[model samples]
Target: MTLSNSRFLFSAAGLALASLLPEQAAIAQSAAPATITVQVNKPGGAIPKNMYGLFFEDINFAADGGLYPELVKNKSFETDDHLIGWKAVKGAAGLESYIVSSDRPISATNNHFLRLSAKAGGADAGFVNEGFRGMGVKQNAEYTFSVYARRGPGSVSGMTVTLEETRRPGPGPETPPSGQALAQAQITGLTNEWKKYTVVLKPSATAARARLKLTLDGAGTADIDVVSLFPKDTWMNRENGLRPDIVQLLKDMKPGFLRFPGGCIVEGITLDNRYQWKETIGDVAARKPIINRWNKEFKHRYTPDYYQSFGLGFFEYFQLSEDIGAEPLPILNVGMACQFNSAELAPISAAKGPNAAGQGDEPTLETFIQDALDLIEFANGPATSTWGAKRVAMGHPAPFNLKMIGIGNEQWGPQYLERYEPFSKAVKAKYPNIQLVSSVGPSPDGDLFDKATFKMRELKAEFIDEHYYAKPEWFRQNASRYDKYPRSGPKIFAGEYAAQSVAIASPDNKNSWDCAISEAAFMTGLERNSDVVGMASYAPMLAHVDAWQWTPNMIWFDNLNVYGTVNYYVQLLFSQNKGTSMLPVQLPGNAKNGADNLFTSAVTDAPTGDVIVKLVNYSTTPRAVKVNLAGAKKVGKTGRALVMACDDLSVQNSIQEPKKLAPKEGQFAVSGSTVNYTLAPNSFTVLRIPAKK
Candidate 1:
């Protein structure tokens, strides 16, 4: 009998047998074991070097409180409400008042400064700063406290800085500062000219919810701007650096590239608030701050105090990519706001060119094109060049070697196409070598997305970005979504995608095992179609446990610690095991993908001379399969299997139990050219056998 007819007959016989027997006494017969054949000799296509990468956006306090290690929230007092993180000393009747002053500021851009008028000098006459969900400080760790301060007409000779743990009260409007001090330092030299003061404070005890207090020594007035408290041990131990633990986690992943500066932040709530890369560079204190696009975007998790300090800006992003050994891929604004927001677009016309547009005037399509050109120059230009000089002044004399740039972020329809036409042409006219990635609609499938894809093909775009956030079942079923894609058109960038356990953007969604396994099942398709799908990454890369607005992030952290989610491990495994070339795999009945709840894909690592086979078994029962490495010259007797399996789909990782759902490695014996292995229930497995053709 044919394969389909034999399966049908087997099911019919099983149903008949079940009908004849008692419900509780019935016993089922085992079906035939499955087989996967890998054509090792026929390596089809070369996998893109930058295949599996990362997508970073400034949502969920991913930058300010999560990655950027600056302890102070509004360091320069630059938020709309200048006193968001500052509170007056509760029992300080001696202190007069404090106000945000802009008189004779540090710079034209950073206009706000905290001016304190003290009636008397004592421990009580000061202000308290509640850090990002309270600072996470370690015992015997040194923290650098720096602030820009200048004395006004007063007798205040110095300032006292103290780090103390916060105390909670029982049912009343209460004070926040705990009198017990963990660390203390003093700033003795107060000058009329604005000068930066620095001192190191080593905490005597570890505190998870510590607050910083600044008290004056003498009765007087003082101005403070750019108040900062950063950990001494940062990533690479550089000044104004990232959190070491978080950076180490990213570096360990070996991501192929880093696409940065944002998702919706590229197109702001309005044209005015869009992330301007120019403003994000230069001195960290001088980089102007703006309200985060996600501050009030979601009403359920409303963060009215959310804002972007731009401390972690384009320069820092490029530096981070270099440190992690990943290519830098920067996405820029295309003179269009978010479609879901205002749907604003800049005027497009032939008259709008380099000579017509002024720096201070309203933006045109040419302004965006010019920005792209200048960005390329800034990233890869000689030190003698204009924008490149800015790079040299920032201390990086060498080029960032940027290769790819995304034009827009999750945009679609005729407006995008019209704007993209001239923008692409202008960029290519100047920097033809730089590849451009065009954007499509938010959802993966629809009339608008399809039409945009068609238009992008006609435009001969280098890459088309497609975003999708859907149920876990959608990911499992769409494992072969790109199997039939045309090979001659633009390559695919699965830019921002995650399998939502609940629903897209739902506050209740979780980074559960089910969602991670579903993503693995779909990533098999990404690997199988490496010829057309050049790049892919998970969305909203990081989230803070206390200050997050979005769910299902790849990595989650709090003030002091971070943990990779179940989805993070899946991405990590795929990125670490991505092979050099595609090795075609054949399953039972020549199924393309996801047959019988089993998903499989194979690739060969050139350097290691090993065959890497990735498999996802979604069934609840263990599955026995024979992996036949066909046309192999020599196969090692021993092999390795890295597996992550969980019985509960809803189980997740927390700060306390980070590695509860991590991968485990074990050895398996390979007999001749076939390896017989049983996949555990609901597991994602990667098998590596040392073999060569």
Candidate 2:
């Protein structure tokens, strides 16, 4: 009773659905139908609790504008261009100028502040903040507007903040407000010393592209910094929190772990710009901004204004992992910049000297090692510990229960090996039980990647991180990629992977149905090899519709709303149905996986006492599959199925039509120990049947 793109026409004879086409009839007459057997009683191995998870990186506006929920882009005026998101709005008679100044600012770290000088006070004599693709405000929804301000040699005794609709002017000129205010709030007190101010404004009408205008109350000068306009409604209703909708999408997956901070963002363009976990931990305002590594990385989608404000920093990452009930798997910079970038690397030790010539003020490998140790302390140490004390001060007294840490993000060769040896040793020496995930470079399979994997095995690493970004066909063809991997060596962590509809990193890449179904086919191998493949997650978890620099993302969102792509549903079905123990699956003809364009894996959920089977039909024809749950006692008469299918492979989901390619749930009857189900064409289906050993 599962609804999908492909269907069967019942015949009076009940022998076949309908008269098959010439080729199909020939095939049906020549051979028997495909049969899959799930050995329910013979569970192969215990599936790791954290097998399927999310890999989060700050690319494609995934953090600042997308998930962090801070509508104001350059809230702190600390970007290389201080006025990146701010512009002056001159009145007919007042408003002299606006400049970013640093004299006696709010703090040394947050040095830059916007100083506005005006000859007179008026509604138009203010500066407007062009939010992240314009603010997304809802009707009657309260927004918390806050700023740090002080008097600056003027009669400006107060500030007027207005949330107004933005008018789209022609190019070159600054975008101006439409003069109609959606919400308004006023701050009356102005002190000589820098202090934070807060006010809440409720919009009378919803405006997706609204702007925030802050004007002077009197003719004078005033300084303002850290201006933020955040929605009052957030995940858990905590201040400086994440967008509830996006976080809800993540939580729904029931992910095992949340790998954070980055893919390449951990390895910056230069050693100096590398992501420093310590810097991302303390006061949100004090955390300085750095140019995002993805900015201008692709010439086709050049985003010059992309910067990391660290508002959604390490503390928030750990907190978010906890909120989503996922183990925090933090990846740290391994004393090296991105191999694709400048390839700057830090020395193994100060005594050993710089690895490469012309390296500038790079912290030694010991610094990176110490950072890893301190991160453990920050995550799991006692309150009396220095780093744990800082965590407690941030309202999280209990440890985040962090387990494993990734050393490098896609690094390879002798450089990675030499540095990783000491790094892993140091971490193990301090915290012997802590597992480490070492890198095997960016490519899924290559001479260098294989060499790196060999080296990691030699080093006796806990996990070898493998990454792959390839075509849809590659994923379907490589359904058994891990079948030949040895079962006794270091475990495998498929750290990052996605099926590209187009070329890898291409601007035209899409989150198409074909890619999603193909990934599901490939993931069956990972599930089958759970004894060796411990963890896996899709890459670049999120992207903004208007501000994205990358494609093929799992989730897409705008300033106002969010939606999961077709690939997201595929991932959701797998993660949510990942059973407790692996069940052996036998395919018809003793053929290899992906044989005849059909792929499958099975598992048993001990808690629910259900036999779970996942099947993928990559062909354009309906497939009647008979699943024999062998050695089962008390098989329920009915079972549930979650299916996602599309006749067109190119179909995708958008913000307006979020569920255009979503999963459908239905129930099917089971005859004794056998379940017969017809999989729709180009579909990924999961069956949960109640049973007992």
Q: Number of the top candidate by lDDT?
A: 2
Query: Which segments of candidate 2 are over 4 A away from where they belong?
Result: 1-31, 170-179, 351-360
- Model 1: how far residue 306 lies from native, Å: 0.9
lDDT of 1 by residue, 1-693 (tens): 000101111121112233222421132234455889999989989989999999999999999998998888898988889988887763445578888998999999889999888888877678778888888899999899999999998898989999988877423243454657999999988989899999998999988889899988888899998999999889999988899999988988899999998799999987777888999999888988899989898899999888999889999999999999888989988888888888877778644323222444567788788988999999999999999999999999999998889998898999999999999999999888999999988989889998999999999999999998999999999999999999778999999999987888999999999999999999999999999999999998999999898988999999878999889999999999999999999998897689988999999999999999999989766566789999886899877777787768877888998877887776677888888766666889898889998
Q: Show the colliding residue pairs in model 2.
A: none
Give the Cα-based TM-score of candidate 2 against the true structure.
Answer: 0.95
Error of 1 at 128 (Å): 1.4
> How far in Å is the alpha carbon of 227 misplaced in model 2?
0.6
lDDT values for all models: 0.86, 0.87
- By TM-score, the best candidate is 2
Q: Could you tally the backbone clashes for each prediction? A: 0, 0
